[model samples]
Target chain A: MSTSTSTSLTAPTASRVAGTAVLLGLTLAPFLLGPYAVATLSRILVFALLALSVNLLTGLTGLPTLGQSAYFGVGAYTAAVVAKNLTDIGPLQLLIAAGVSALVAVPTGWLAVRARGVVFLMLTLAIGEIVYSAAVNWKPVTGGTDGISGVPPVVPLPGTPALELDGLVYFYVLAVFLLLLGAVTRLGSTPFVLALRGIRDNEPRMKAIGYPTRRYALTVYCGAAALAGAAGSLWVSVQRFVSPGDAGFEIAALALLAVVIGGTGSMWGACAAAALIWLTRDYLGNLEAVAGRGPLLLGLLFVIAVYTLPRGLAGVRLPHQPSRKRTA
Target chain B: MAGWLDGNLVSVVDGIAFGLLLFTIAVGLSLVFGMMDVLNLAHGTLYLAGAYTAYALSDGTVPGLLLALAAGALVGALGGAALTLLTQPLARRGHLDQAVLTLGITFIVADLLAAAFGGEVLPTDPPASLRGTVDLLGHTYPVYRLVFIAVAAALALLVHLVFERSSLGALVRATVADRDMVRAQGVDIRKVLYGVFAFGAALAAVGGVLGAPILGPGPGVDESVLVLSLVVVVVGGLGSVRGALAGALLIGQVQTLGVALLPQYAPFLLFGTMLLVLVVRPHGLVPSAVRT
Candidate 1:
């Protein structure tokens, strides 16, 4: 607790001013940029949430699940269905999506928590693939590969008018992104988060000390799944559609890769990395000169990150800033 | 009765053939992971390399096919050696490091392969000798498939004898049991790792070469093969040949038969089976005696 207080003080004392400046710059970016850029930023923010969820599990809990897309797809589909049938209230839809995703994750996490190491990863992957296949084949409910479309625009906060246009929706997305960002950041600093990190490093010791490791893992998994679900909800709201491909291996893989690139155990790092990855895939990958080489570039990034920046973007020293002191 | 029997039996036969193919590919993965305590995510890259080599070398003749297989295996050995060397720095760091490095290698090799051979799925045809089919239980089956099954089974038997019966096998087993003990006894642990890694890679490439006609050479084939191999290794228990065989056969039947019987649910069925297996037997159906 004292360390937390000291850490908070030190963080602000050193980087608080710079951090707030960056936040202000990001918030005001859309006002200066075009509608196209705003749309891309919104998409990046959604993926950043997804990457943070993956970080919560893989980085903090030491559960390198390759199946976060299951929750993501579930959330998207839930949001789509709700928008289609029940309500277009963005906040309500996000809540329902997260709730449903967490509920579904309970049993899946139970099954997954039984195994550790690579077995855990494989099981999660299998579960994810199963969900993806279901979405693809359950044509009556899911509409198969065609996916569900024409989702209603999400209602802004306080029952304000719906965000009908892309530019208007960006503000809505930005608001939710900031809220979720705060929530996950707080979660990362909690006792549960500390315990999860301990479990990742020394599960046996934690268990020997009488901690219910499996229960802890399941709890973290559910929390991460809920966050992913929230991301999925935002995705459906933004794209105005839902598809089985939302639950595809690529999303799950990219989420984990984002966490890896961001520096595991750092929520902000994951968010930053997710934005970078999405920008690369959406903007850089689409460049005429670099067309069709997105995967090649991604692969090169993976190689370079593994070798050079083992701790990822978070750990990289800023050009002018002094290096942070190492902790014991 | 005859029509029904043929309809059902044909798929059963097909299932067995496909399962055998999977067994050939997955057994090496199980062995390497089980014995070495390393997870080579790049295992499928070796398979892809083999398929590509076949695409590059073969003149579409039986001799060419044989030459392609040999070259594929040779390339696999070289790739394996390279992986061993590349991963040597992280050897002391443990499985996490190995996984990270191999995953990196998977992306690199996959990209390189895509760059070299356009992203298209390069279809590989069987040799002229296997171009035709023969009647089997009232249904015609590809002759190449039967040949593939025979060749794979023969190789499996050879592998069985070498690992299960020979002195080299005992030494390998001993190495798996206790690396420190093996090294203390003057057996080079590094050499054992290199040999096993090479052998495992060669086995995967062999499967790729033989399986290319059926699986086809493609951009994502490497990842798919890797996932299937992971499933097999997990199902069989890591490092256990018998477990890999059993898991492969089971998955093979599920894949081929599921496709024939319930095409819509086929993909889900494979993963569902894996989930069921993991729940029932977390250590897999047949766990390794020397658990890492």
Candidate 2:
């Protein structure tokens, strides 16, 4: 739990410049990228959102989780059901999905917050596996692994036309991704997040200082679950389908890996690592040589990443960390 | 209620067999964690490897099963030793790194196993002698399951004796309690670490070899086994053999009997059970005395 060192809020101007530059590139990507690339980027954006949610807990809040995908799956299924029966409005689906996911997180998060370290990870994993089971066995609602399909195209607004084109959907995803990114960035600086970092750093000390660490852990857990749910909604909007696999262990694992590989406590790092991982899993995995060896290659990436990128891919500290020959 | 109880007596018996199987796998996981503070996520891969050994070596004979068990144990020990070597570097990196690193190993091994054995769950049958049915309290039961229960119970007793009553177990527990203290006594603490890890891994693999017929070995089976063992260890209190048995049996009942009674809520039953345990006994029903 105290594995990663803390990342301070430095390089504010450089980071802002990089953020704007990345946003500009993303805004112009639909024109430069092919439909498939655009669609993949959309998926990456959504996954990045999920990874950010994971980072909220692991990187910022100090609780490592392998269960965020449970919330993601809940959101995806909720959005699918809402789109199929209620409305095709993208924002509404996102809202309802996030809300339902947080609601589902209440009891689950409460139980999860009762423990820390490996115990917490184990609890969350059980929560995820149980939800995955529900998706597979609850045939009436979850459609029993075949999953809910035939989702209507996501409408961005009340009167706006549905987003059918990959580029259009990509834009919508990017917009939401950027919005959440800003929110999380703002959240990182808040006193509440400082308290969370304190809890992560030393929970006993925080408790000694009169902080309700358990309540904070639970609150952040629900918030992260809600964020994961929103990402799932974006996923539904992008794919126009929902499946049990969306909420499976792989999704949760990948999100956790993204946070870890991106440099814990760094939102930008999480997004970059999420993008890289998705690209690896989706793009490289489907190659002819390793056509169905997606898991194998991803596994290799995990091993290699763990060894070679110990500080993570986005672990750039221009002013603080100098290059080193050995671990100090 | 009487009708349900009478009808599900078979389920209760079956739960015993299943729980015993889990204990065989989970006890190793529990002790390794209890002693080493290392959470090897690839622990389930040992079970899968053993199952595949059963699938590969089964010749409808007792010798074949014994051979498979021996081979599986060797494979598991080698796997554990190798894991110890790989994970040793990350010892100071904290458990998150250890967990993620071992998880990487799990993914790699699971993928490799899936590649070699194909994607489908491989069904392994018991030896000719253990095959077929037997009458148990007016209910027809598989002979192999009854045999499994007996063997697994003996295995559990052996484990309990070795870990709780034996001098080696005392050393392992002492190491867990205070590594510096154990090393100060001139004991090669790393040897104990490797020994415990390899022994636990071997036990898990042996369970796989034995439980192949019950749980089967497949692509995702490794993950499922890992999760189940994790739950068992958590419920039984981490690193405690007694706790693993208690938790495994309870879960086995919930899995088998609960499913038989309410298929719709079987999965939730597992979660709800865990939730209740966490709420009522956060350290588990039987927590390890020298906590990590």
Question: What fraction of native interface contacts is shared by candidate 2?
Answer: 0.47
- What is the DockQ (computed on Cα atoms) for candidate 2? 0.41
Segments in model 1 whose C-alpha atoms lie over 4 Å from true places: A1-12, A317-328, B1-7, B92-100, B288-292
Question: Model 1, B160-183: lDDT tens per residue?
Answer: 888889999888888878888999
> Who wins the DockQ comparison?
1
lDDT of 1 at A306: 63
| Per-candidate interface DockQ score | 0.44, 0.41
TM-score of chain A of each: 0.92, 0.92
| Predicted complex 1: DockQ | 0.44
Cα lDDT, all candidates: 0.83, 0.88
Interface RMSD value for candidate 2, one decimal?
4.7
In model 2, state the lDDT of residue A165. Answer: 97
| Candidate number with greatest lDDT | 2
lDDT of 1 by residue, A1-328 (tens): 4566764676556677767886897789878989888889888889888998888888888888889999999999999999899999999999999999999999999999888878898999998998898888888878999999999898977558988877788888889989988887777567888888778888889999989999999998999999999999999888999999889998998888788777666777788778877877778878999887777666666667667765677777333333321110
Clashes of each: 1, 0
lDDT of 2 by residue, A1-328 (tens): 3453345344566678887899899999999999999999999999999999999999887898999999999999999999999999999999999999999999999989988877788789878988998899889998997999999999999999998999999989988988888898888678999998888777889999999999999999999999999999999999999999999988998899888888777888999999988988999988898898777777788788878776777655533454321110
